[model samples]
Target chain A: MYKKSRARYFFLMPGVVWILAFTFFPLIFSLYLSFTNANMRNFTQATWNLVGFQNYASIGSDLRVGETVVTSLYLTVGSTLLTLTLGTFLAWLFNHDLPGLRIFRSILTMPLFAAPIALGFMGLILFNETSGSINSIIRGLGGTGVRWMTDSWSARTAVLLLDTWQWSPFVFVIILAAMQSIPEELYEAARLDTGSGWAVFRSITFPLIAPALGTVALLRLVETFKILDIPFSMLGGGPGSATQTYSYYVYITGLRNFNMGYASALAYILVIIAIIISTVYFWRVRARFE
Target chain B: MATLKKEAVMQPVRAVQIGRSPLARILLWVAVLMAVIWVLYPFVWAVITSFKTQREALEPTIVPFLQFQPSAENWSAELGLGARETTLALGNSIAISIGATVLATVLGTLTGYALARFRYGIGNRNIVSWVLSQRFLPPVATLIPFFLVLQRLQMIDTVPGLILVNTTFTLPFAILIMRDFFADFPDEIEEAALVDGANPLQIFLRVALPLATPAITAAAIICFAFAWNEYLFASVIAPKDAKPYTFLVASTSTVRGVHFGYLATRMLIAITLPVVLSLFVQRYIVRGLSLGAVKG
Candidate 1:
């Protein structure tokens, strides 16, 4: 039995080592680097200064930092809600016994598979102020074209809209699968009770799939918070930093500005926020299960 | 007696009537159509934009199709099959993504099987949670340290470096999905194989592996898609020799005097592999997503 236990440890060794060296090690090292004033110009032989809590302090007081955080939070929350609502509605629609339903589901999920950077460029072209297809459609509908990438509000909306368009299909697929798994007998019983369509849904479908919905929502929230590629590639966080998400801000600081230490601090804060939000969401989910 | 007969007659009629209201049918069709347009219009735009000349792309038009003379010059230039530099980048992306997926799948399967079969002293719940949390850590936070570590090891700007970095992100997901799949299998089969006097390795290879082929295939497809789509790490770790097609599409627009048509074509080409892969594995992809998101 002891030998068998030892063999199991041996089986686990390679994966554990890989994670330790790659994942955990880098995580700890980055946490330590957040305190020092590291940058590209003074990268080598740079004396590390232990300015405890100063980096964290600066994050709160800095106006630019605060604005970026608010913008990121807004983008994350707005996109999450939009995708969840829209995706749920689509899932419900496709869930019905309609003809060509499989084909519709497949078509709807195509965007999820497209490369993010490619989709970003596509968004840029489609939402471009003067020459975009969207604007052209608006003009055809007797409204003037909107400045999607140039104006602040519109730019933020563009990012949120693009993200929702791309990711809602993910939620739709998952929720649809969960809906299919529900037992038909439950719905039959509700029907026997002379339940209306709305009541049947409320009493049966919604409760049964709440856990799946919660999981999808939590995953989306976490992903949206870290979104960098689409907004960065599309708007470049331009028109006065209007669309600058936290991840993009970190990119600019670390890579563009070469402020590794401050960027590390920012990254840590982002991680903390992600952990807290996910934890809260998961706690609620756990409560539901119990 | 008349009242009871009336109630009985009304119930079924009401149920049938509620099922297919004209308003409900119209709303459902509208919702489905809207979703289809939302997801597909951009891709259609990319296709149309790819065909237009540079000047045509700049001009606004209400027509749903291309207004200018379509050309293939942009497609040829963007694909880089005619040029050395661009072709090299495309090759590098294909090699790295494929390598990373194969490595991740192999290692993930081994680890997954161990967790499934061994039932080690460490609580199974802890192991599962740890695997899931691996994905929760943002790659940006760990970028700098990974960069420094790779640089010190002299692995940056190499295919191996990109593979190593991608594996960190991909392995956890592969393990999580694969473990769920393995758990769904019956342990009785393995016990029966053991009773036949086969060694552990032989049993896994000859019996369990064949049984888990569908799941393993699904996990592989998911990992491949992820590695192919990954951008930030690929951009930072591979500046020159090891840059992928995604980095190519990103950097092309920034280059001065580059044509928009050519850029659009490049974007289209870059998306081709992933789109094809996704279409091929659409069913498995759905399965994997359900397993990952809807915990049993």
Candidate 2:
């Protein structure tokens, strides 16, 4: 029995080592590095100056840091709500006994599989200020074309729109599955009661799929907060940092600016936010399970 | 009073039973058409644009049609099939993605099986949460660390390095999905195999794994798509040699001059592998989503 247990531990050792070396170790090291002024130029023979809480304190005073956080939050929250609501509606629509429903579902899901960077470039072409497909459509409709990536609010909206266009199908697929799992007997019971469609959904469907919906929302929130490639490729966080997400900020700080310590500090802040959000989500899931 | 109430409800019931009114039928068809168009227009536009000539694509035409003369010049240029550098990058992407998918699936299956069958205290839950938390950590947060590690290991700018990183990103989700799948599986089959003098390994390989083929396929496809489509890490780690087709497509920006034709061609090529893979595994994909969502 002891030998067998030892063999089982050996079977587990590789995965455990990989996770510890790559995931957890980096996480802890990053947290430590965040306190020091460790730039890439000094990387070879690095001297750590421990500035207690200075990096955290600097986050508030630094305008760009504040803006990055605000932008990331805005994108995360806005995209999650829009995608969930629209995706749920579209899923419900697709779930209806309509002709060519499979084709519609497949087409809607195409963007989900397309690379984010590709989608960003496509968005650029589609939403260009001039000589673009979308602008041309608007012009044909006798309306002036809006500067999508130039204006601050418009740029943010563009990011949100691109994210929604790409990821809503993911939410749709998940939610559609949830909706489909709903027992037919429950619906029949509601129908026998002569209940309205809204009443039936409220009484039967919503309560059952709430956990699935919550999980999807949580996943989207986490993923959206970490988004980098699309915005980086699309507007380069653009017309003066209008769409610089926290992840983008980290990239620019660490890579472009070579401020590793500051970037690490910013990253730690993101980690905290991620942890809080994930903890709440898991807690809610557990609560639901219990 | 009861008779009056019954009659009041009967009128609406009678109206509904009549059904298939011309107005309702027309409205339904119209709604369905709009929904279909909304879903398909982007892809149709992409395909149409890919075939258009450079000048034709630039023209502000509201009614762009796919009837124009088609050319494969852009495809040849973007893919660089005749050139060594571009072809090598493409090959690297395909190899690394496949390698990572296989690695992640195998490791995830083992870990998932352990968690599903074992009765470890708090450890299983911890592992589950740890996997979930991996998804939450911003990919960028780990970029520097990964770069540093890869550099130290002399694995930078290599296929194996990229595979390792991609596996880390993909393994968590695979484990989560597979664990759920294995949990839902009947234990009696495995027990019977055990009773036949099969060890745990044999029970897994001979009994449990066969039953989990559909879920495993789904996991593989998802992992492959992720490894294939990942951009930031590929960009940072393998800027030159190991950059995938995604990076290739992004690199085709119209900064100096708009190469709409070439851009469209590259985008189409980049999306081809994933589209084909997804279509092949569409059934398994649906089963996976349904299993994960509904069961949870």
Candidate 3:
């Protein structure tokens, strides 16, 4: 028995070692680095000395300090709400009987599979001149063209469009599965109670899928917060850094500008925000799923 | 009251299918069409643009062959790099993703089996939760640490380094899914195997692995897709070497000049493999994602 147990214990060794060396230790080390002045500007010093909150203090003074936070939050909130709402609606649309629904559903998963960086390439073309496909459609219809990529608001919308396009199918598919798993008897019971579509959905469908939607929303919220590749690739955080996200800023600070200390501080800040949001979610919403 | 309510509920369905009016059904079809278009428009556009000549690509015509003559200049230029860098990048993505998936699956299946079967105390729940929540460690927070660590080990610009990093990213999710898979797997078969005098390792290899094929496929696809599409780490760590397709696609920015045709060609190449694989395994995906807090 003891030898068998030891052999079972060996199963976990590789994953544990990989996680520790790559994730856990690095997390701790970065947390430590957040307190120091170990940036490019100060690496010339003989040895790095901990500055103790100075790095945090200078966060407000950083280039990505104020508007970047707002922009990041705006992007996260917008995309999360957009993805959940649109995904739920689509899921609802397909939940009922429809011919060729399987094929449509599978095709919908296409964007979910397309690389976000590749989607960035598509957006580069789609949001190209106002004469691009979208604007071309508008002009062909005798309407004025909008600046899809150059203007700040339009570029922001373009980013949202790009994200929602790629990911909403993910939420849709999950919600639809959750919807299907809902017992047919419940809908039967609710239908006999009232013919009101709104009431039936509100009472029967919504409550049951709430947990799944909650799970999906939590995932999307965190992911939206980590948005980088598309914004970086599509616009390069351009139109004057209007689209730069917190993660983008962290990369710019740490790797681009070589401001390792400041970037570590920024990363910790983002992690704190993540922790707070997740804590709130687990405290409030997670129990409903259970 | 029940009969009345049934009739009332039937109104929407009847109205939706009123063949005489056709309005509601048309609306439904229109909505479905819009959804289909919303998802597929970009790919269609990319495909069309990839086939267009430079003048046509820039001029932006909707009709492909009708408006301008088609050309393969962009595809040939991008794919026909002196050393075939795009092809190399595609191969790199495949190799790295395969490495990450294989490592993640093996370790994950083993750990998942242990978590599912072995009865441990004190640190079990904590360990499981720690492993599960590791998925939430945003790449931003871990990027530099990984880079510095990899650079120190002189593994920064290699496929093995990517596999090492991506396994960390992919392992937590794979373990969670496989744990769920194993937990939900029928224990009676394993018990019968045990009665047949098969040991744990043999039971796992012979009994468990085959039974979890669908789940293992989902896990494999998830890991492969992740490692294939991963960008930031690739950008920072393997800037010039071990450049995966994602990095290569991002590198072709209009920063020089917007070659829509050229960029679209690269985009199609970068996206085709994973997209096609994902389409086949999408059923498992729906299952894997709904259970695993969703895979990206």
Candidate 4:
């Protein structure tokens, strides 16, 4: 038993070391970088002065920060609501035993596994303003084609639509799992008592699955707030930065403009927001286990 | 009044009958068909676009034979021997994803087993919780530090550099999943091995590890898919020679204009691996996505 207990550290040490070296160290370094004027030009020189919250101070005046935050909120809330609604509806439909239902369910969840950025690139072709299939469909119906990428609101909508398309399946999968976990007897009893499908669902199925749905919703909230790949790939933060997300703006500042210090500051702000959201998520997750 | 109330309560059960009436069934089927189309239309569009010429690709054509003639020009351009960059990027993706998956699986399995089976003096719940929180860290937050660190090590734009980064990002998923699996695993097997004079390490290697193959594979495949689909780190740290297929797919628009046909081909390449692999791990996917908090 002594030998067994000691082996536990043997198992744990390597992962702990790797995390400290890779995850923890980089996070600490980023925190430090946020306080210094660490520009790409100075990086090679290996010299940077400690700026001490100047980077944070500049954030108040930086219009880009405010704009990206607003854009991110829109993308996050819009996509999350759309995905949840579609996913819940699909899950409810899938809960039924129809012929070839497995095949249809598999087909519907395909987008969940596809790379988001790749899908975003495909979104470009699909939502293309001219000679695009979507526009063609609109024109076929005798309505003028919408400018999907050129217009700011339209570009934001394009991003939201693509995000929803990719993630709704994920919500579907999670919600479906939750729905299936409900005992068959519970629904059977509810049906016998109420003699109404909607009543049975409201009294039994919904209450049981609500927690799982909440968890999935919170998960999507955190994920959507970190939306970068789609906007980056699809529009390049385009239509004059209208589609720029918080992460997109941070990437631009840190990597593109080579303003590492300010970028780190922006990143820290995101971290704070993420931490707040994740705390709620962790609380919910813990509530279930406890 | 009481009899009328009783009738009123019973009326909705008949009037609002769900999924039973012929019209309702037809409507349900139509909704299901539309849902499938909504999910699949993008991939269909991309496939069709890949077989198009630049001019044809720019034009909206749903049908290949009727609306336009399908061509293989884009495929040749992307996959031909002359297309060294595209092929090389694809190779990088495979190499880096596999490398990270192998490393993460080993580390995560060991750590997860230890947490699940042993009482480490520190609170195991806290440790597991901390590990779960790592998944929430924004990639952009770590981008600069890793870039600078890798640049100092002179490892920028290298496959190994990317393998290291991808492993870090995906390690949390692996650990949380394996921990959940190991927690649910029966200890009688290990207990029997212990009676036979095998240490925990020996049991983990000879008994537990062998028995846990399915769980391990699920964790590994999930890790591989994440690393495969990764873009930000690949583009930032490994922009030159080590750029993955994801980077290539996203950057398809180049000088002159986007050859829509080529873009479509690359998108197809980037998505095919995960979509195919997803079929194998369908049962475990929700467990993976929810960090094993919700079992599928």
Candidate 5:
């Protein structure tokens, strides 16, 4: 019923123009910077050169780069698994009606909105080997205190635990919302026919919410790959690069080491990986949606 | 079990399990209680630690009066008048978050309205998918280039620069959310408005926008929270003067040492605003967090 008018451009042009100028232009510039020999000390035109493929070539030989990739993958996959399991379990638990459940829901999901950097710092305090509360409780129970910060595997576990603590709520809230959206009559009917909760869930509830679960899971997967703030705040990629994510490494290469070319190259590699995963994500989601 | 069955309409999936044995019910409650403790213990511990002295902080003290004496020393040191950097960082965070939220919301809402209500043919589909694709773009990919561009423009270490960068990342979310809200809105009212001799912009301002207040507010809140929680852009682009509280949350240590009490104080400060704001918009948060995929 709405008329076709040119004035729609009035609404669309400003945002489109802003994104093109800010986001698109910077990305194209970054792609160009990835091939050049640009460092912070001589970032100006006089010293920079458009050296083709040198930065990308060195990526093949750089062992630390490979290690960072493995680290990034491990953290991403591990945290995704941890978050999905905990979040889905919580979602299922919260699906029940109990006294004070609403308040519990609020309290449980609070971590999703809290600043990750601060939460990471909180992890440091909570996971401290000798004096932290977790180890203290463990020791009080007659167990040995863990070396969470100093040990390599323990440090990675610390980072994963902190990330899962913060992000499981994202999965929980999304999955719960999806679960709650299902019609009650379906479960009631299933129960009358089967007279079993597990049968009702498997027949009715699980299939309906599987797509939503997939959406949230893939979202978490892509996001966890860009895990920087947590490890940056908690360990600063310590214990000799135990918890250094790809994004953290990129940040170090670009800003800390001032190697803009190599950093841009590293960043592009991540961009490519993100693109592949998200492409698969979109394909799966769209197929399900269709 | 009969009462739970009666309540099944409200919690269908879970209430179906009411026929379980008493022991199973007890075990279920135990699991729920443990989950609650897992979720809340850190924040509770943080509150406890914030009140302790540095010496008390070193110990695994749980209670305030029994195990350790709580003091306001950390609070005073962190928020006192002498804490110039802390206060400035707080101001910078507030300004930058609000600034970016406002800009992104205004532009995104207008654009979203166009996409939702008007037909730009295949361009609409392309624009929607392209905007969604922008969310997948890693921030690190653009980090160096933004640093360079902002540096050349002399906008580095400035509030406006940080705001611009934050707005860029958050604009896609705002657009998608506003578009979802606008698309779901019934067209009959707008059709009546058009028949009443009103233009599209006039209809939007007088009719549609007021109805969309909750959505616009939700979009703005999510944007503000994201910009407030943002650390990467602010770390690189606004290091010196426009340093945010998120950055300073990590920089609380001095030549003295890493003060757990002091760091806890800053962490609480950094998170309190977003946590409180999320409470007010709890219903709309699901849609926002899920990028409008779930109709929460």
Candidate 6:
């Protein structure tokens, strides 16, 4: 029995060891670091005390921290919903083999290949108020420039749009795969029986693809929680901290402010929030997937 | 049975789609055109801007090459015969991506094979989910410890350091995709090999691995792309020589002065590799991205 198990152990060893050293170790160590003064200032000293609960306590008192959570939630929820709606719509629209299916799908995936930071840069330049091409066209038509970066609503909109636009393709690809897998007979039968498009889609397509939809939503939600590059690069999470995402907050806390302990705590908070949301979301669909 | 039915039904559907009902096909094509426009417009502008002079980048042209003069100045400036930073960053990016890909694929394939073929105790199912959840841990959670740890080891600003971090993030997806791949592998073939006196490892290495080429290619490309496009950890960990193009792209745009043309040049350079690979393996990505969760 031991010999029989040996091969499996051998195969699993590297990944398990790597995960332990990198993921689990960092996770536990970060928890420890969150309780102590582990910033750059204290690094050379080679010593620091346990300032227990101080980091966690500070998270509540910092108004920006609270606002940043709200900002993250808003983006996470907003982007997930928008990406889902638009992506599902696009997926269904492109479900049929039309002209240039190959070309359109390929082009749609182009942004997904580009770095998020590059996309952020693209967002930065394209959404620029004055020199922006969007405004350039508007101005050419003799209209005033819209404050895309300066105004809060428009700033958030720009961030949301970028987030949604870049990610909607992900949703489309997933849902389209799901939709493709649904047997055509079911669709054909539904079509023959039901005259309305809504009836066929609702009864046959939507129900069949619900689990895939759930998976897409869950994945998108978790990913959107960690959104940093686009909003940070596009707006620096500002126009008065309007778009300061949760991960960006933790980034500033650790990297910028040198608040290692607090940032570690903030990271835990982010993880905990993600865990809860994903767990709740997964509970509903877990059985269905299996 | 199903394929035959599908082909039969699709025959008429195709006829209706293109020949009989021109309006619906045109409408579908129009919707597709709008989406394609949305995806490509920014990239198109970036390309046009890359060719424009610094002056032309600021100026809006209704028609590229007509309203403004097109020059290779930006591309030349950043990507010319002797450009060092861009070249170095590209080299570092390639090293890190390839390094991470090799590590992730080799280790992940084994682990994925084991998970797919064997069953542990009660925790059998939780393992995949547990590993996948690793990605959800905000990079900041690991960044601080990674920073401190690497600083102690004096491995900071090194390509190896960047590769290790990239490997960590890419491994889960690698494992999951490979697990999905191996799960989808023909059990009958492996069983037949087992009956022919091949041990599991031999069967895996000799039989399963050969059959998993599509998945392996997909896994390799996905891993490579993830590492190639990684920015946050790359920027924080690699301060100087080892920083990848993604980090340079961000820093050059935000911290340093904007040579808008140079920026566009970097953008085009940065996207070329992943874009090319993705286009080449476009089918694999959809499967890889969904972990083959979607049936098709």
Q: Which candidate is the best by lDDT?
A: 4
Candidate 6 stretches greater than 4 Å from native: A1-5, A42-47, A140-143, A280-290, B1-21, B254-256
True contacts kept of each: 0.44, 0.34, 0.54, 0.61, 0.60, 0.52
Question: Model 4, stretches more than 4 Å misplaced?
Answer: A1-4, A42-46, A287-290, B1-19
Q: How do the predictions measure up, each by TM-score?
A: 0.90, 0.89, 0.90, 0.94, 0.94, 0.92
Q: Which one wins by TM-score: 1 or 6?
A: 6
Q: Which pairs of residues clash in candidate 2, taking residues 3 or more apart in a chain or in different chains?
A: none
The Cα local distance difference test for each model comes to 0.75, 0.72, 0.77, 0.84, 0.83, 0.78
Output the worst ten-in-a-row residue range by lDDT, candidate 5 chain A. A281-290
lDDT of 1 by residue, B1-296 (tens): 33453354233211112256788878777877887887777777778788778788887642544446777777776664566767988888888888889888887887777776676666555565565566767778999888777877888889999999888888876776676666656667778877888767777789878877766787787788888888898888898899988887788768835455676787788777777667655555554553354542
- What are the per-residue Cα lDDT tens digits for candidate 6 across A135-250? 88788899988888888778877888888888899888888877877777786786678677678778988998898898888788888888998887667788888888889988
lDDT of 5 by residue, A1-290 (tens): 46468778888888889899988898889899989988877554213689999999998898888778888888889999999889988887877765666677788878888999998889888998877999999899999999999998898888899889988988888888888888878877787798666787778878988988888878888888899988888888888898898899899988888888988998998788777877766665432111
| DockQ in order | 0.40, 0.38, 0.46, 0.48, 0.56, 0.52
Q: Interface Cα RMSD for candidate 1?
A: 4.7
Tens-place lDDT per residue, model 4, A1-290, is 63347778998888888999998899999999999998976546334689999999999999888889999999999999999998998988877756765577678778887888898888888999996788899999999999998999999999999999999999998888888777777876777787676787788878998988888888898899899999988899998999999999999988888999999999999888777877777766753221
* Error in Å for residue B54 of model 1: 1.0
Q: Write the per-residue lDDT of candidate 3 for residues B130-164, one digit (tens) a residue.
A: 66666666789988777777877888789998888
Model 5 has a clash total of 0
- Show model 5 residue runs off by greater than 4 Å: A1-3, A42-47, A193-196, A284-290, B1-17, B20-24, B254-256
Can you tell me the DockQ of model 6?
Answer: 0.52
Candidates 5 and 6 compared by DockQ, better number? 5
Question: In candidate 6, which residue pairs clash?
Answer: none
